[model samples]
Target chain A: MAVEDKLKIELGKQGVFVTTVNEIYNWGRKNSVWPLQFGLACCAIEMIATTMARYDLARFGAEVFRPSPRQADLMIISGTITKKMAPQVVRLYNQMAEPRYVIAMGACAISGGPFKQGYNVLKGIDRYIPVDVHIPGCPPRPEALIHAFMTLQAKIDAQPLTGTERPRHLDAAAMSEFPVPTQGAHDLEPPANRLVWPLPAPVASGENCG
Target chain B: MASSPYFSLAILFLAALGFGLAPLGLAVAWAKLVSPAKPNAIKNAIYECGLESKGDAWVQFRSAYYLYAIIFLIFDVEAVFLVPFAVAFTGLGISACVAMLVFVLLLAEGLAWAWAKGVLTWA
Candidate 1:
C-alpha cells in the first residue's frame, strides 16, 4: 500500500477527524458539552430544568454533567458565592483543563442579584473567574438559558483564536508555590438546605450501552 | 424629582469599580506572597499554531479583536436589560411591554448588522 493510503487507514481506525486546531475547537464547542455540577443555590434547580425533557439541554450536548471540575469544560455556577466559597471556586477554575469556560447562571452569581446587599455573598463570580456568559434572573426561564448558550456559541464562533499563552501548560516550578488548595473547605452546605423538588431514584434499565 | 439619579449612578459606578478591582488586587498580592518560579526553555517560549513553537508566542493582538469584543459587550448589556423585562412580563402594562418589544427589536438590529458584516463568522 502507498504511504498516504496507509496513513489514511491508520486515521480511519482511530475514528478521529483530521482537522486544524481551530476546527477541532469549533467542533468541541458545538458538541460534547460536559458541565461541572456546581449547584450552589436556588438557581441550580432551574439549571437542572434546562437538562430535563421540557427544556431538553441534550440538544446542546450538555446532558453529561460531571461532578469533578478537572474533567468538565463548562462550569455552570448556578447560585451565590460566599467569601468562604471564593477560594474553592478559584481552585475549581484552576483545576479545569484549558479552553474551559464559565457560565454565571443567576442573579447571585452575576452581582449577588437579590442578595447584593448581603454581608457574605459575593457581588459577582466575575471578580474571581473570567465569566464567558452571564444568565441573569432570580431564576431564568429555560428558554432564556438556551438563549444564553446560543449567544455564547455565537461569541465562540466569532472568536476562533485563543490568546498567546497556553494557560493549560504552566511552568512546573510556578505550579510548585501555586498553593493550589486541595485540602480544607471553609463553608459547609447548611443541612437545612435540600432539593426543593423530589426527583426520582435511578434504576438499572436493560438497554444497550451505545 | 428631589433625589438625583446621577448621584445614585455615581455611587453604583464606584461600587462596580471596587468589585472589579478587589479580586485582581488579591490575586496580585497572593502571587507576590507566593512568588512562582520563572519559566525556562520551552516554557519561556510562546505557543504557536499547535506546534512545539520555535520562537516566542507573544503575538500582538489585532485591533479587530477589540472591535468585536466591544460588539459583544453591547449584546451582553442587551441581555441584562431583556432579563428584567422578561421576568416582569405579566406585571408590565401593555404599552410598557410594547416599548420593551421595540427595544428588543433595536438590539436585534445590532445583531443583524453584525451578522451582515460577517463579524459573527469564524472564517
Candidate 2:
C-alpha cells in the first residue's frame, strides 16, 4: 500500500512530508526524462519547437535532448520510418539503457501518416519496438507533443518498482532486444517483428501475408 | 594520534574518500537489489550512432607531417610572444627590448631555415 493511504493530509499542513521510496524514485525518474535527440521528418520541427523558449519543455524537466541513446530515457519517434531507416531505429532503441520509454509522435511514426500506402514507409514503429504513448496527428503540434510527454510521465509514475507488472528493465524475463529487419529483394525480410507485432489470424479466403 | 596536527587532515581525507565512493556503492547495491542487468551484443557495441562500425580505428599517418608541425610552431610561437611584447613595449627597458629582439630573431631564423628547406611549399 502507498504511504499516502495511511498518512493524513492534516499532517502535511503541519509541515511534515510523507512518501515511500517508490514515490521518490518515480518522482526523480519522471522529472529527468531526457529524450533522445533523434528526428526523422517534419514532426521533428515541432519536437524542436517544444524544446525552445516559447513552448519551454524545460519546465517539465525534459529539455535536455541527449544525442546518444545511452544517456537518453525517452525516444520520441517524430516522423516517418522508411524501410531503410527502420533497422537503424530499432538498433538504436535496443542500445538505449533500460527503463526507456518511446513516444510515437505523429501520424507517420504512429501509422506512417499519409505515407501509409507508400511502399518504402513502415506502417508503424510499434511493429518493431514497444511504444509507451501514441500521439495522433499528421505532424503533431508542440502542444500535442507536450501532452504526450505528460502522458508518458504519468505512465512512468504509475509503474511499480517491484511486481509481475514491473517495467522491462526491472524484470529479468522481459525481452532485451527486438530483432532488426533487413532489406530484401522485394521488401524488408520478416516485415514486422512477430514478438511485438503479432500477425492477425487468417481470413476465410486463403490470401494472407505473414 | 587524536591530538596530532594531522588528525583533522586524516579525517578530512577519509571523508573525501567516502564522499567519492558512497554514491558508487549505492549504485551497485541498487543494481543488485532493484534493477537487473540486461547486456546484449548491440548495446555493448563500440559505435552509438545506430549503425554498425566498419574498419579498424587504427590507421597510419604520413611521417612527412612532422615538417608541417615544425613550420607551424615558428609562426605560432612568434604570435604568442609578439602579443605580450607589444603590450609591454612602452614600459620595457633596453635589456628587455634586446631580449625580445633576440627571441624574435630566433623564431625568424627557424622560419628562414624552414623556408630554405622548402617546408612552406604544399608539395
Per-model DockQ against the true two-chain complex:
0.01, 0.53
Candidate 1, which segments miss by more than 4 Å at Cα?
A1-21, A162-210, B1-123
lDDT for each residue of candidate 1 in A1-210, tens digit (9 for 90 to 100): 123556766887999545456555566665776888778888889988999999998998888888765557788888988756765676666656445678888799987888766556666777556778899788887787788887777666545444543332333422311122222232222211122112232111222111
- For model 2, name the residue pairs that clash: none
Q: How good is the docking of model 1, as DockQ?
A: 0.01
True interface contacts reproduced by each model, as a fraction? 0.00, 0.72
DockQ, candidate 2, comes to 0.53
Give the winner by TM-score.
Answer: 2
Worst 10 residues of 2 chain B by lDDT: B31-40
Scored by TM against the true chain B, the candidates give 0.46, 0.69
